[model samples]
Target chain A: MAPALFHLFALLTVASAVGVVATKNAVTAAMSFLLCLVGVAGLFVQLDAYLLAFLLLLVYAGAVVALFLFIIMLLDTQGQKNWGFKKFPIFVSLIALGLLLTGLGTFVTRGQLDAPNPNAAGGVGAALKPYAYQLFTTYLLPVQVMGFLLLIAMLGVIVLSKKIDGVEDVK
Target chain B: MIDFWSNLHPVVQGLIKGLAVIMVIFPLAGACSLAERKVSAWMQGRPGPNRAIVPWIAWIPFVGTFLQRLGVFHLMADGAKFLFKEEPVPGHVNKVYFALAPAIAMMPALTTITVVPFGAYFNAAGDAIPLVLANVDVGLLAVFAVSSLGVYSLILAGWASNSKYPFLGSVRASAQLISYELSMTLSVIPVFLWINAPGAPGTMSLAKVVEFQSLPGFWGGTWFVFLMPLSAFIFLVSLFAETNRQPFDMPESEADLVGGFHTEYGAFKWSLFFVAEYSHMLVGSGVFTLLFFGGWNPLPWISLADLVGWLHHATHAAWTIHPLFVGVLSLGIFLGKVLTLIFIFMWVRWTVPRFRYDQVMKLGWQKLLPLAIANLILYALAIAFIQKSAS
Candidate 1:
């Protein structure tokens, strides 16, 4: 049952990820991107990382992807031209292809190919407790720094989006 | 029969429960629509939906007249109208998304109900069986996570319609849902924080929450609502907004947005959005009742433990009461509470005028969010102080 769910969601994630890049319309791309996120979330659930699964759905599927759609809609991309295959640069493509192959080779050689089922150790609540404890205790400073970084980014967004009285003519 | 039933696969059990839930919820959603009309009519001093009745039933005497006057058959009429109505997709609309939106909208509302514990019954082996569909450990989180996907449906419908009204409606819906979602999530933290056993991870399970409320010991087994009234209030208001109910229903304010994100949708598809909305309301009310009210308990600090003494003596069975008897009584209690909450929803819909879009946003972000955060902090401090004193 677990293996079947894993394969199904994995296939869906890959297909939708490809669809995200392959689609012409921005809205269609965004929708496919959402499907990819959902598939990933499903995979997380299959692995018994229920916290990560829910968070992925809640944060990404619920908010971030919706934001992407909102922005796409606001921009009115109905008339935007689709990118053509001919416009791609061969050298950049070759670099990306080489990087992917190297990463896969390294993963196959070094990664633990048969890690034991993580959920076997404890229930869902127990699984999340230690990760949460580590985040708040050992990694507290890094977490705070990340939060501060997000705050600054939010401030930047507010500043950029703010309407200045004399800015329309100046721009 | 009982042994055979108990031995069935969990997947098959889930499928059966899920189907049963659909049968119940779909009809309840229809009934809510009927109630909305009746309630609105009463509030406005007018006769409401008293006409639609089956001809055969209507031909009977006083009982038939009473039934007709109550408009018991109106839901059937409404369902038929929706089914037979013309479904015209506008030419310029995005065909794929337009078709997909209603199904997406309805899915989460249906799925979220799985984790909501209507009742719990003790089996013959003295095991407590929760009357929930999917008894996941992260039950409440599962509800939130699944229901959040509902916003996508509204956004898709709005954008796919490719019309100005729907576009605006969807945008408002996204912003509104996102804004309230933060406060909604935060407000529930305090409930779980207080419910948590010392040094143990806080439970997100609905059944656990109910168990805490029903137990005899530990803070006198008080309902979370009375303990954290402010949290309940915050949660309740957030729920109203989250379900896009009255005053906060700016997204689909007919006067302003002409049915909002579903402006272009008609007939069956349109009804699906309403089903989704009402289902959200139903589930939200149920969640509130579970979190705040003493779910499945006639009163707080009153579990089946108290009844066990009497039940064992009466039946000469094991300490556990019969699942069927307990199940029916608890289901009745749970549904009674839910219906009361639904009535309040309808009452509020009639009593409160719609909030202006800006006011809705302000209340969600400025008012509710800050209040919820403060509530969480206050509860945390109180819990810490109590723990320190106890030690």
Candidate 2:
């Protein structure tokens, strides 16, 4: 049951991701991206990293895709639509596709997929607990440095976005 | 109940659990909105929502009853108002994408809570009851990946809306999330290293990490907060920006983006964005508790073994409440911690001023990234030194 489910999800994911890159309409492509994200989240679940799977769905699908939609909407590019690729681009796409297919075929034929090692100490949940422990103990300095870095970044963003002299407003 | 019975397949069960958590959290999110309003109101020295009372009930009730019922009904009324309001689809926008954007924004937020283990599991009649929806080993990674997708929703909404303000918001969001994502991931690497130091032999599981800290001495069995205060602080601040909370919420700053990425969104669709925001906050806080606060472990240093020993003596004969009950107790403790953290999020949101957009970006790139990398290096050296000294 698990293998079958995994296969189905992988097929859908890869296919949609391809569609995302291939589709001409930007809106259609964005929709394809959504499907691709969902498929990736499913794969995460299959890997037993439920937290990562959820994060994939929550952050990427939720915020990132929505951002894409907002940009597409704001652009209002329908009136200026350009449907077909130029001849040179088509040739390039075809060559790229061929290389990708060959690479995938080689990977499949090699049959070197290794099973998960159960004897490994941490397993899936291993990182979660110790991550907390080490953060406080061994890695304390870097952590403080990170806080400082964020503080600096925040100040930089503020300065950049501000209205400075001689800068023309885009709008 | 009957409908639930009919839909009892594993997938359905999973969906049901997901929905239940969403249902529980949704109202909580609504309450969060109210709390935001109230906190800001208090900060500014003004009354907030004292007059938004239950129609007939408030007139007939005493203080306690009226306040209790009003608190409960407040979210319902807010939801109903949103539902009944006219949903506007602005001109020149792609209708389908516009409609779908909100759902996209909300779905992942609701789903991310599944792997958050609020409690432990127990077996009854040989059937194990896992506290979480799914207890996978790579739970933390799953959380990280899912949260990362949230940025896309804002991107899509901005693009599909075909408006300038929304477009700018999306642009900012993309650059912001991507830039911060590196540091966010890097900041946590030290944690992973500590969990799986050399000779540990196996990956660090969440359960085992908690177990290791539950040793008997004063320093042996305590929360990691004391050991790595800096990491905890960094993680918390980054978490705020990662979730797009205030002081870090440049994407949706009303003064700047004019509603940010979802400026064109209205009615139920707009509400979905809020839903996603609150849900992300909830999940983020839950993970924060799990990672740094000793997850579900009460009294900081308390361990399951110690509890088991105490329970064995306390109940003596009629210890009928199975080990699962103990797990549930621990989970309850964990949930309490998460809620407290969430409250802190709300408190902070109302207290701080929003960061300027460029400031938000600069903080992520210039400061957090380098610092996170430095922390990772420092941790690596420390671990090496400790191993050598011990041997």
Candidate 3:
């Protein structure tokens, strides 16, 4: 049952990812992206990481995708159907794709990660307490840096979006 | 038969349970529509939907009239009409999404019900354990995650309608639902913090929160409403907005937007949207009751265990401790509170005027969000202090 579910989710994720690129309509692409996120969240659930699964759905599928759809609809971007990718970018993406497949080939054929001890103190997929403790302790600096990065991005968006009536008001 | 049932896969068992619950909830949502009509009529000093009746069934005298007056027949009529009515697909509208919107509306509403524990039974050791469909650790968060997807249906409906009013209504809906979600999420943090103390299992389960309220003591036995009325208030307000009940019915503001996000919908599809809306209300009310009113408990201080004890004391019968009896009674109490809350929802609908779109936005972001944040900070400090000092 677990293997079947994993295959189902993996298939769904891959198919939806393809759809996101293949679909011409902006709204359709956004919805496909949402489906891809849900499929990934399903895989997370299968790993006993229920918190991560729900957080993924709640933050990305719930809010972020909805906002993406909102903007796509508001902008009515379908008129740019003729705006296909240029040859140079396509050539670059082909090289990137080859590099990705080569990386995957190396990992599957030769790469071996250090087998984690099952009795470790805490890890990413542990139950809430150990998981939370790891974040605030072991990964504290990285977490704080991520928080600061998000804060900076938020400030940037506000500054860029907010219109000012008078320019050069500051001394 | 019992062996076979026990041998069934957990997923199969869950599917059976989910189907059973959805069957019950679907009709109850239908009944709610009838209740709304009757309540609105009563408020206006007029009869509502009393004229619809079966020919032979109406011959039964006082009971028939009572049923007719209560509009029980109208539910059946409404169901039949929606089923048989013409399902129109407009020419200009987006075909796929227009067809998918109502089904999308229903998925999350019904899915949320499985996460909520509706009743309880006292085990032999005498702990009142909740009977739920899927008793997951992230109970409330699962509900929030799924129900948040409900906005998609409205957005899809409005966008697919390919019209001015629906487009506006859907936009307003997505904005309102998203805005209120922040406060709603923040407001419940305090409740969880109180329930999950220093050494506790750190669960966000709704049943465990109820269990915390059931514990014997001044602080323990008191419902969260009496303990944290501000969280309850913020949660209730957010619930109203999330469920799109009046006066927060910005999505459908029929007066201005001509049925809001569902403007182009009709027939069974339209009925599906309203049913999903009522289901959301039912689930929201149940969550509120669980969080604030001591879910399945008879009163604030009186736990279900206490009630069962009192019953056993009164009757001195062996049947009082029976799981079936306790389950039914607890279910009755939970449903009783839910019905009362639904009535208040309808009551407020009749009493208050629809909020303007701008006002809804302003209230959700400016007023409720700040209030909820302050309430959280206060509760966090107070709970931290109490737990620390006690240790």
How many residue pairs clash in each candidate at the backbone level? Answer: 0, 95, 0
For candidate 1, the docking band is medium
Per-model CA lDDT versus the true structure: 0.87, 0.73, 0.91
> Which candidate leads in DockQ?
3
Misplaced by over 4 Å in model 2 are A2-11, A14-18, A37-87, A90-171, B1-9, B53-60, B63-70, B121-130, B304-321
lDDT of 1 by residue, B237-322 (tens): 99999998997887798988988999999999999999999999999999999999988777676765466556678888842466
**Considering summed lDDT, which 10 consecutive residues are worst modelled in model 3 chain A?**
A121-130
Best by TM-score: 3
Candidate ranking under lDDT, highest first, comes to 3, 1, 2
Q: Looking at candidate 3, what is the lDDT of residue B250?
A: 91
Candidate 1's displacement at residue B350, Å, is 0.5
In model 1, which regions exceed 4 Å deviation? A83-96, A109-127, A163-170, B3-8, B124-127, B304-320
Model 2 residue B27 CA deviation in Å = 2.7
Candidate 2 achieves a global lDDT of 0.73
Candidate 1 chain B worst ten-residue window by lDDT: B301-310
